[model samples]
Target chain A: MSGEGWVAVVGTGPAGPEWLTPETAGILEQATDLVGYGPYLDRVAAGHQRRHASDNREELARAGHALDLAAEGAKVAVVSGGDPGVFAMGAAVLEAVDRDTAGRWRDVEVTVHPGVSAMQAAAARLGAPLGADFCAISLSDNLKPLAVVERRVRLAAEAGLVMALYNPASRARPWQLGRVLEVLGEVHPPQTPVIFATAAGRGDQERLTVTTLAEADPARADMRTLVLVGIPATRVLQRPDGTLRVYTPRYYEEAE
Target chain B: MSGEGWVAVVGTGPAGPEWLTPETAGILEQATDLVGYGPYLDRVAAGHQRRHASDNREELARAGHALDLAAEGAKVAVVSGGDPGVFAMGAAVLEAVDRDTAGRWRDVEVTVHPGVSAMQAAAARLGAPLGADFCAISLSDNLKPLAVVERRVRLAAEAGLVMALYNPASRARPWQLGRVLEVLGEVHPPQTPVIFATAAGRGDQERLTVTTLAEADPARADMRTLVLVGIPATRVLQRPDGTLRVYTPRYYEEAE
Candidate 1:
């Protein structure tokens, strides 16, 4: 393994070409190898760079492979969908580096670059529902216990913070979203607004549904969805055309 | 007031030109007026567009002015540092639109474009400290009460969520950061890693400091700084050159 190579973990920011930042594009342009999940790797334009596509659940393996290639003098770019640092490949790459027992990749310079996150994209589509203090929780119980997820949702709701829930539902675990909504219902008011944004930033596939806590159905969400639950200060307004816009007020009325 | 105008609220993503997205740049190119705080408005390249810069504390007025410009048949872009949807100008603009009486600007279309947020930028610099669930809390009590901020911190800390603290301190509110630290100390371990990233994404002014909760000083942070508090799964590693990197592991050991 040589010390001449480096690895950069970058995010494409959802699924649009317009969302890619110049910094990430620069790294992608200079990379000798690109590694990521199949769909995310497909986002980049086909070029001379060697592609290492893998399953979505194989983040650690992919990270280790990228590090090994970088240690062997290959400039590698690990691609992710949203911001690499937020529930993405950046941590997986670092975890691989930490587990490098032989220290072979010590000289391989690793850098993580920022990108727009799913929550940010969803919030933008919904007109700034997360304009105040907000929490991002992954509803997947694969990494943490459901009890912990429930407790965090309840606490965040009680604190009156807007909540952005990612990985709301998967085929394997179908009941997580219902439980989350149940926990949210116990803390927030029935009229609290909820937003379901699916495939945001992915033109043509984007869909947004706005409802309230009492009427928000868990069936409206899937793995591709990002759900936002509002606090008491959140408002829902209707346009003349009957479209609804939701936003959380920057200031609390009673706080003043 | 006319129906032929629109306003796009876009974020510049902390600082630096590379952080600006193509989507935001396209909007900026077509805008007839740019409305935002003086520093944020200064980010755009001066052109034929009219500048409507205001004080940092006057987000609502700035937003209303932007709406007025749009209603008068001008294309306006409201610039914010980092994602406008996240505690920036996006919500303020929506609030102003909602408060518009007599519906003078009813036909004025408003949209928010997502940008890299300060937390995402800071986490990238610190090597993915926000890999899992995280919360963004603005320490400034100008909008909400200090009690509300403190309660949210305690609940978020207790939930084991990595926290990104924004506006940690200001000239007039020096005690909020200390109180946040005191509350965090009660829930998190003393050895928990804390990161201070100032002026992130700004080419020459970016600075990062790594320390533990027990040793972290509130004075090290300012309004331009973003502070990250890690969970038990977070780790700090050193390269052969003695440079440090911090990251929270993607998977919890006990969860499996």
Candidate 2:
């Protein structure tokens, strides 16, 4: 099950088939099997002739199965949104490959394709708000402890860095991001701009209101939502249509 | 020449035709005229049925031409690589439309189709080095002033932030990135990780040796290079093959 096998960890992009890059799309189209989280697997186009193993909690096992299929001379893709290595299945797949096949897996050509991360998608929606110094943290304590998350948040805020919060909250960990906000409040001003971007690039995609840090409601966020907390220098400019765009001035030369 | 017309600023992804998302591809396929920097236009599929205006120095003029074509009832797509808003023509087009067309272009709907930015491409090559806090700055002062660029660099480095420096250096501005390094050296340790990722995703793409801040050679960098400077906490891990990867410790949970 571990001979002549290779795995392509592909990013399905932030949302929808339209956002999928040609390289990623080509890999998916050529794969004989697709393995990923249940929701992410559902996002791949159906034109690809492939079998799929979609399980939310069985990532490790699914990775093993995909490697097995690849060993059988089948092209395999382990799909993840954005870049797989960025808080996704890339490290897991590599670890699984290493453990299952030992150093033998090194001979197999493994390629990790990049995708548009939710942070980038959120920044685009917010008018280059991430153009300044920023940090990204995943608030989910499922893998790590809340204390670690808090420390990073506190450090970033105290250092006047913008932050992008992933996995801010879900059904089971609904208060994780809220706790994070509480910790951040100690270091940042209450008027700091906070952007809630949900389901970025998906059908129900919505860029929620940018409010002051004290006003952000974590309950309104979900697994698909990305929270961006700006530093003191971040500003929200309101448009005539009542929508607001957030940006951190990077101070460019005055236009001649 | 701008009544009831629309413009779509599309991203052509990192490579050839396959990298173009379906939405962007569809827009380009339907466009009567495509406008962008010279190299980007050449990358579009040869069979593309559109007149193209490829000029680097004439971005604003090309954008105006695209708007004129759109006003004449021909759908127009002003294309850029990666996301148009990042450091591309999308913002320029919008700004020009705002200034030149005013109310006349109000009815003109404009949509920005996102693409894979070079930073994401660089991150993928380096194995998620950008997973933590980061900022992006363009060192080219052609359209922007050097003072503005210096301010952002100083702020980002002082915050111990990872930074993605685009347009690092070129034939005429060979010493820009060196000056940036000088500023960064004052704030960050001399041993910080610096990655020079050039021609990412192309056949000739080269992922340079990631070295410490004190050892990086800016002379080897160019406009096509995307330079990543890691923060204090960022560490370069050695793979079995001795290839390096960068990761910022989020410190998840404290080991209880």
Q: Who wins the lDDT comparison? A: 1
Fnat, model by model in order, equals 0.85, 0.28
Clashing pairs in 1: none
Candidate 2: CAPRI quality band: acceptable
Candidate 2 local lDDT, B100-208, one digit each (tens) = 6355544455656677777777767766566544566666556455665666677666544568887787456667788888888887878888888887767666656
Clashing pairs in 2: A22-B18, A22-B19, A135-B133, A145-B253, A253-B145
lDDT of 2 by residue, A56-136 (tens): 666567767777777667778889887675667665565565465455444455567787777777766656566544566
lDDT for each residue of candidate 1 in B1-256, tens digit (9 for 90 to 100): 1246898999988888788999998889888899988898888846789998888887888888998899899999999999999889999988988998789879888889999989888888869999988898887657777887888899888777889998887566788888888899998878889999999878788889999889999999977899999987789989787878889886654521
How well is each residue in A1-256 modelled by candidate 1, as lDDT tens digits? 1237888999999878788898998889888999998898899846889999998887888999999999898999999998899889999999999988888888889989999889889889878999988888887647777877888788888777789998888556688898899899988778889999999978789999988899999999977999999987888878766667788887766631
The complex in candidate 1 yields a DockQ of: 0.82
TM-score, predicted candidate 1 vs. hidden true structure = 0.96
TM-score of 2: 0.79
